[model samples]
Target chain A: MKARVTVTLKSGVLDPQGQAIAGSLKSLGFANVGLVRQGKTFDLTLDETDPERARAAVADMCEKLLANTVIENYAIEITA
Target chain B: MKARVTVTLKSGVLDPQGQAIAGSLKSLGFANVGLVRQGKTFDLTLDETDPERARAAVADMCEKLLANTVIENYAIEITA
Candidate 1:
């Protein structure tokens, strides 16, 4: 099975890295760029075959380690 | 308009960060985890309204700055 997890900062949270990227973009001539928020993606190859079990397991992983729920949000996708 | 860019390491590329995360997961009791690869997601709010133009511009950004084409691939999605 394969699972994908996307972890993004919650709205209203300050993202210094994103801001820096935006500034760089402007300097690089992409002045039309607005807010740029950076996040993370995790691609996982799992041994579990069952789709339901895989999703549940990956969801647990997201909650436990893949994401910091206080200031970040996560979305999971699983494929068998 | 909003655009999303997902940047991932190409196959066969060494990802030390992903390896470290996998190690942490194993220590955290996720023994079932297999190959774990980490990537990046960029959420961009663009002033451009035309979907085609937004996609093109973001693609250029990815090619030039958001991703290293030598060892990474990027996918772009634009939403109006």
Candidate 2:
């Protein structure tokens, strides 16, 4: 099975990387750009075939290592 | 309009960060892990209301800044 985990900063946390990107865009003459938030995406191929078990394992991975729960949030997407 | 951009390294590229993650998972006793790849995700709020225009602008941003077309690929997903 294939699973995708996305880790994003919480709303209240400051994202300097996103701000830098936005500023660079503004300098590049992109006036339509507004708030930019950046995150991490992990694509994992697991030996597990069961979608339910895969989701659970991926969720556990996110909690244990992939994400910092205090400042970030994680979502797991699983495909068979 | 809100758009999400996901940037990922092309297959066959060496991803040290991903390797480190995978190694860490293995050290943590996750034997089911196969291959792991890491990517970047951007949540962009645009001033443009039209979805088509938003996607085009986002694509431009990706090509010009967000992604290195040489070794990386970016996907623009527009919602709303």
Candidate 3:
């Protein structure tokens, strides 16, 4: 099975990288750009075949290491 | 409009970050994990209401700065 995990910063947390990107966009003539929040994604190919088991394992991984639970939120998507 | 851009490393590229994550998982007792590729996701809120324009602008941003075109591929998603 294949699983994807997206980790994003919690709202209200300062994102300097996103701000820089937004500024660069404006400088490059893309004035319509607004708030930008950058995040991380992990695409994992697991040996497990069960979607349920795979998702559970990945979720554990996220909680234990992939994400900072206090400041970041993570979502998991499973594809068999 | 809201747009999401996911940037991933090209296949065959060495991803030490992903490798480190995988190693950590193993140390933490999650042995089912296989190949892991780490990537970036940017969630953008644009002033433009048109989905088409928002996606195009985000794509341009990806090509110019968000992604290393030589070794990364990006996918854009637009939401109104």
Error of 3 at B36 (Å): 0.7
lDDT of 1 by residue, A1-80 (tens): 88999999999999999999999999999989999999999999888889998888888888889999999999998877
Q: Residue by residue across B3-55, what tens digits does model 1's lDDT show?
A: 99999999999999999888988888888899999999999999997999999
Per-residue CA lDDT of candidate 3, range B1-80, in tens? 89999999999999999999889999999988899999999999889877777778889999888999999999999988
Count clashing pairs, candidate 2. 0
Worst 10 residues of 2 chain A by lDDT: A55-64
TM-score per candidate? 0.97, 0.98, 0.97
Sort the candidates on TM-score, descending order. Answer: 2, 1, 3
User: What DockQ do the predictions score, one after another?
Assistant: 0.91, 0.94, 0.91
- Model 3's chain A TM-score stands at 0.96
lDDT of all predictions = 0.94, 0.94, 0.93
Kindly list the per-residue Cα lDDT of model 2 for residues B15-43, writing each as its tens digit.
99998999998888788998899999999
**TM-score of chain B alone in model 3:** 0.96
Each candidate's interface RMSD (Å, one decimal) is 0.6, 0.5, 0.7
